[model samples]
Target: MAKERSIPAPMANPETEPFWAAAREGRFLIKRCTACGKAHWYPRACCPHCMSEATEWVESPGRGTIYSLSVMKRAPEVYAVAYVTLEEGPTMMTNIVECDYDSLAIGQAVQIAWRPTAEGGPPYPVFKPR
Candidate 1:
């Protein structure tokens, strides 16, 4: 059997460390503002809506729909990338895997998955048909 190649893990800073750490344990974290009850992406320290620093990290259900998608046919291996709107109400950019690229459709049901990264750093979220 052929060996699989690894991709570089995402770089985590102070602001995103918690999210990445939780991902290592197969958990997805979302932040909800204590002030406005709104959730935002990219794991900022403050709520983008209320500008409040009291955001709390909460576990996500890790299910979502494909808000949009594009297949990169030029790649040596075909892959589809898309915006997934989580059940928690945040949209994140992710790769759709474990299926044919042409099978992807907007609003299709999906579930969050994790893939190991290069150099044994951490696993990152990907999406597969649910």
Candidate 2:
């Protein structure tokens, strides 16, 4: 297989460490606001919905539908960037991989696939068409 394309490691902080840690373990997670019962990505201390500071990390179902996509044919390797709307209703930015780039489409079903990167901090979450 081609070397996995990598994004830089996220700088883990107290609030987001749980997310980074889970990624290292080949799992995906999101922050769910305890007060508002809303799930969100880009882990944070406060809920974007109700502005509540109460949130907890929850395992993501690791499945989503492609909300949008852009193919990078000129890159060293063909790749796609996409916003995947997760099953729990949060849209997260991720890459769509392991298939022909021309085959991807908006609303295509996808599932998370962890890829180890050069950064070595945590394997990043990309997706494969489901």
Candidate 3:
């Protein structure tokens, strides 16, 4: 039996509200440091690269390659988790959805897919084979 995966709602704070907002709007966003011209995941106020406060949100193309992955078949629901390297240069830990877990591979191309929170909060980004 294929059980549905339960997605937990992500908590939002002052630092991450905009990111959740954009996700609700069906857009993917990442933080980029103006000081060092580097993009990063898990958006923050200060640039992780240069330690600069000049950071801004940018819409991502919502496409990436799988850096690594693991499929958990023994869980309550079968699901795949992966580290995806975004075209913008940041690798994010995310769920791989809408595909056969056994067929997933490293370096597989993917695009953004959304799953609504179990509590009806903002939807979070997942990925499907592109």
Candidate 4:
């Protein structure tokens, strides 16, 4: 059965406000360091690679491949969590939704899916098999 997991609202500070704002519009975002030219997962003011403050926000295609996954059958609700390596580069920890948990496999292509916030904040990114 495909069940919906209870998604909590994400809190946003100044550094992550833009990300949350874009999420509300159903867009996925990642940070790219202008100096190092490497994209990073967590949005921050500075680049983790070159320690450069010259970073900019770039919209992700929201496509990725599953690096690893685990199904939490012991939880109150069954769900799958995974490290999805985004097409942009960085791997993000996220949930896999809208599919049979047993059907997921490593290297499977997936696309971003949004789970709306119950607290009326920005939606969160999840992945569904493509």
Candidate 5:
């Protein structure tokens, strides 16, 4: 098996600690605004929709379709980075693995798989073809 990469430690502020904890448990979470019924990423204390402090954390299905992608040919190694628009309406920056760089397409179905990190932080959520 390939060695997993190290993920950087989260800042661990009050707003984002719960999110980091959830990711360590192999679950993906997003902040949902109770007031406006909208979900958002990069968790914040207040809802971006209504600026209300009424927000809650909810588990995500870890499923999404590729919204956009870039093939890195000049970077450290050949890899693909994508903005995956989650079914719950938040687009997250993630890496797409287990597929050839030339084979990825927009709107391709993907499911999350946790890649363990050597940094002792949360595992990185990577997408693979479903």
Candidate 6:
């Protein structure tokens, strides 16, 4: 059987194209608001906090703590999805890798890692124990 493809392609948009481009180059980014000194994720055109349109893309520290997680045991094989709260204040949904499924726990420290795709899309960011 062939491996499943998971990477996502870049979306051509004025607000988020740069983000995808950078990710393709093996970088992770988060949106930071200059006016309000706040950071956000999912790449928005404006700051959700202060409603400021002045925002810039900044590289994430890529370090976070696992806020929550769930383990899968069925047809999908074994996998874990976690809500990681980044040190910089953004929570992202990512898969936890390089660790045993039974060893995962809430509040565990993890770091971002990239998973390249054969389909030529932007690398998917997953987490591993720090």
The global C-alpha lDDT for each of the candidates, from Candidate 1 onward, is 0.86, 0.86, 0.92, 0.91, 0.84, 0.84
- Each prediction's TM-score versus the true structure: 0.91, 0.91, 0.95, 0.94, 0.87, 0.87
Between prediction 2 and prediction 6, the one with superior TM-score is 2
**Superior candidate under lDDT, 3 versus 4:** 3
How high a TM-score does candidate 6 get? 0.87
Per-residue lDDT of 1-130 in model 4, one digit per residue for the tens? Answer: 5456777788789999999999989898899999999999889999988999999999998999999999988545889999999988899999999888898999999999998877787899999999
Evaluation by lDDT, superior candidate among 2 and 6: 2
Q: Looking at model 3, how many pairs of residues clash? A: 0
**Top TM-score prediction, candidate number:** 3
Model 3 residue runs over 4 Å out of place are: none
Task: Give one digit per residue, the lDDT tens place, for model 1 in 8-118.
Answer: 988899989999999999998888898988887868898988799999998888899999999876534667879999987889998888876777899999998889998
Native RMSD of candidate 5 (Å): 2.4
Model 4: lowest-lDDT 10 consecutive positions: 1-10
Given candidate 5, what's the lDDT at residue 96? 86
Instruction: Report clash pairs, candidate 6.
Output: none
For candidate 6, the 10 contiguous residues with the lowest summed lDDT are 1-10
- Note the residue pairs that clash in candidate 3: none
Candidate with the greatest lDDT versus the true structure: 3
- Expressed as tens digits, the lDDT of each residue in 1-130 for candidate 3 is 5676877898899989999999989999999999999999988999988899999999998999999999988656888889999999999999998898889999999999998997889999999999
> Which 10-residue span in candidate 1 carries the lowest summed lDDT?
1-10
RMSD of each: 2.3, 1.6, 1.2, 1.3, 2.4, 2.5
lDDT of 4 at 55: 98
Would you list the clashing residue pairs of candidate 4? none
Please report the TM-score between candidate 1 and the true structure. Answer: 0.91
